[model samples]
Target: MKFLIDAQLPVRLSYLLKSMGHDAIHTKELALKNATPDTEINAISIREQRIVITKDSDFWDSFYVNQEPYKLLLVTTGNISNKELESLFIKNLGQVVDLLEQHSLIEMSRDSVIVHQ
Candidate 1:
């Protein structure tokens, strides 16, 4: 899967995804860097057919309200260290990928991954 990692997420997440054999890019790689607006991110996601991985609830709202981005992975694990976050991905990424293959919205917390209708 291809991914556009949001600014709120660590760039390391992109590397992890890439290492796992997925194409991924962090917001830092964009011309606006971490400052890229959500709308532009949405456009990129749609144009490139990338799943948006973000902690921002704004994307969540937009996903439901506008269906702007093609797909979304919303991280709801609040205030965790980057290592813990990466570990969470390592543990659940397979299931997450399977779910995303069939669903447009997914929520990942510290303990579980939820597939949204």
Candidate 2:
């Protein structure tokens, strides 16, 4: 699947996704800093058909309440180091994919990845 990593996530996570053969883009690559609004990201995700990967809960409003069909991968693991975050994605990307097929939201935490369909 395609993905656009939010500024809150390590930009390098995009590399992890790309390494796994998925199309991915980071905010930096888009020249979008922290100021990029959630709605804008949601729009871009819809336009590009890319899933939105973020740690921010505000995007939930855009994806769920606002009824944005763009896929969402929310990392709710408390503030963590970059390495830890990378490991989480690398280790569980398969399950992540499975969840995505069945749900719009995957709240990836340290212990488990919760799916919200």
Candidate 3:
């Protein structure tokens, strides 16, 4: 799976995803870097068919209303350190991928993963 890590997420998450054999890129790597606008991010995801992994609710709203971004992983494990966020992601990523096969929107928290159509 291809993934685009949003600015709110650690850049290391992109490397982790790559290490797991997925093609992934962080916003910081792009020309806009961390300042990339949501519209641009949504455009890139559509162009590349990348799954957007973000903590931003804007993407969630857009996905539900516009059905853009191709796919989404909305991280809801609020107020955690980057290390903890990465760890939680690493622990649950496999399930996330599995669920994404059938669901376009996925809400991932520290305790559970919920799939939304």
Name the candidate that leads on TM-score.
1
Instruction: Please tell me which predicted candidate would have the highest lDDT against the true structure.
Output: 1
lDDT of 2 by residue, 2-104 (tens): 8999998888898889999999998777745667777788888889988888888888876777767389988899989999998888899999988888788
TM per prediction: 0.98, 0.93, 0.96
Which parts of model 3 are misplaced by more than 4 Å?
Answer: none
For every candidate structure, what is the RMSD over all alpha carbons to the true structure, in angstroms? 0.5, 1.3, 0.8
Residues 1-117, candidate 1: write the lDDT tens digits. Answer: 999999999999999999999999999999999999999999999999999999999999999999978899999999999999999999999999999989999999999899885
The global C-alpha lDDT for each of the candidates, from Candidate 1 onward, is 0.96, 0.85, 0.93
Instruction: State the weakest 10-residue window (summed lDDT) of model 3.
Output: 81-90
List the candidates ranked by TM-score, beginning with the highest: 1, 3, 2
Query: Model 2 off-target regions past 4 Å?
Result: none
